[model samples]
Target chain A: MTPEEEAQLKRARRGRNIALALVLIGFVALFYAITIVKMVD
Target chain B: MTASANPALPAEWRDFFALTKPRVMSLVVFTGLCGLLAAPGTIHSVLGFTAVLCIALGAGGAGALNMWWEADIDAQMKRTAKRPLPQGRMKRTDARDFGVALSVASVLLMGIAVNWLAAAVLAGSILYYAVIYTIWLKPRTPQNIVIGGGAGAFPPLIGWVAVTGEITLMPVLLFALIFTWTPPHFWALALFVKSDYAKAGIPMLPVVAGEAATRKQILAYSVVLLVVSLAPWWIGGTGPIYGVAALALSGAFLALAIPVALRRAVEGDAMKPEKRLFSFSVFYLFALFAALVADRLILGQGALS
Candidate 1:
């Protein structure tokens, strides 16, 4: 692969940690917010 | 000239207007507007307009920066090769600079016109998509769109905060609906655009996960999305009318997702289901939010303005 392609794939890889973090955060809302999950509140 | 043949560039000067990712902006507008409308407190008409303006500007700014950062990879991908920057009609530096300007200006305007909270969320979203997601995640990970999707989901929540000056369950439901909807929505496109994303060296889910895993994930997310979409009505954020409508729409969304989820691309299969899901996902979010807004309108919920 060219430098551009290498850089591209490498760049795409950096998002995994962020994605995991965000997904974990969202998942936390599911478990914790279950009691108070009022839609109109 | 390339501009002549391009569909977005009309004969009139106004034709250039559509290229700013107007369809996406309209979604931002509608969601933000719904957030403001659904809020219990009063926001002045002008402030509400300013809030919507901020969402549009912020969303557009992020899109521009996204285009600027991805120009090289976009040029390689068939799906995005024809975007303005990659097409050579627009200067790369110009896009970057313009994106920076709009992003900063929108944040500032929102802070001045609405609560600082909305502006902060808008700023964070812009940075999330432009720098964190685009510059960091997109080229590197299979999960890029999953994380970056939050950038698109912020508009309604921000708008709700803009009007009410606080985050609440209803707005959070709106936020969750969009957040959960993102993966299945983009994964559908990734199924067919697998080649384009791979050729661009981007690790989209279909490219990274393989088709079966991608399909399973799509179905999983769609189911979650359907459940979350109904939360507003279930929790009293909206009435049964909106709930029933959302259930119906999401049933259709699931119907589209299940086939793709079950099918393997290795067989003699066309990419129609992915395409169909992609098309319906567009309508799914729009109409779901529209139903919410319409519910408020019918219930004699006072207008935001």
Candidate 2:
């Protein structure tokens, strides 16, 4: 594969990784919020 | 799209997002949020937000599954030929997996965070659209949109259930409002896009019943929608504010629909009336719901009293 194609692949991988991380964080926060609300209620 | 055949190619985030049908998702989310806000109760803001989020995710999931299943049919129709799965921008298996995951996760989270009733309704709605409407009805029957309308009507009801933990007259009325409105809303578009449905072999109302009958049906459904939209006011569920808004809106809806019903389109004549009604129908729903929320906020609970 050409260097440019390899670099594009790397960029896509990095972007996907960041998106996955954000989704994980969102789920974690959502659960935390729910738990806190339940505890207080 | 040519690169999609390569197993190693990464799907663009936009392609995956397109699988969710974001424009339709936005409408679902908005209606769901409005229902949550308009329901008669106090809910923790965070919990309310969570419920809306779950509704949005569940809707997105259903859209993905529908697209995944209909990719082949969609490819044959000009209207949906550009969808991610239809265009080969995403693998059908990947879309199916993503849809199922989102559906399950959203329902489970909603159950855990809010109430089980809301979650059950959410799950049922997702399956209604993806399995019942897309898989069973759409290809087989002209009544697909008629019955499938129930799927879109669930969000507001689910949102209300999230707050109240049960169904009530007001939310049910809201459900009926959308249910009765869908036939006309969809049939108008079907009138203009009859060829697309014909090519796809999907029995849309216009394709099966002919344009004349479809026009009559559109007018009939519009009248029914008019009655249903006014029920919330007549049954003492809302105040004069919403009643007035509904009256004006439904009046305009009928006015727009009348021309479509009365005037037959000749070859080479623009289907301007049908197109106008279709556009107005969308705004009509949003405005009606907004008015419902406004009335509720201003008058407080039991505003009709």
Candidate with the greatest lDDT versus the true structure:
2
The fraction of reference A/B contacts recovered in model 2 reads 0.59
- Expressed as tens digits, the lDDT of each residue in B1-305 for candidate 2 is 34444445676677778888999988899889889888988788889999999999999999999999988899998889988776776578999999999899999989989899999999999999999999998889888989889999998999899999989899999889888889899999888888988988899988888888989988999899889999999999889989999999999999999999988879987899999999999999999999988998888762111
Docking class of 2: medium
Q: Among all windows of ten consecutive residues in candidate 1 chain B, which has the lowest summed lDDT?
A: B9-18
- DockQ values for all predictions? 0.02, 0.65
| Model 1 alpha-carbon drift over 4 Å, by segment | A1-41, B1-19, B266-268
lDDT of each residue in A1-41, candidate 1, tens digit only: 55654554455345444555774695456434432432313
Model 1: how far is B84 from its true place, Å?
2.5
Best by TM-score: 2
Interface RMSD of each: 15.1, 1.6
lDDT of each: 0.78, 0.88
TM-score of 1: 0.81
Task: State the displacement of the C-alpha of residue A5, model 2, in Å, after optimal TM-score superposition.
Answer: 4.5
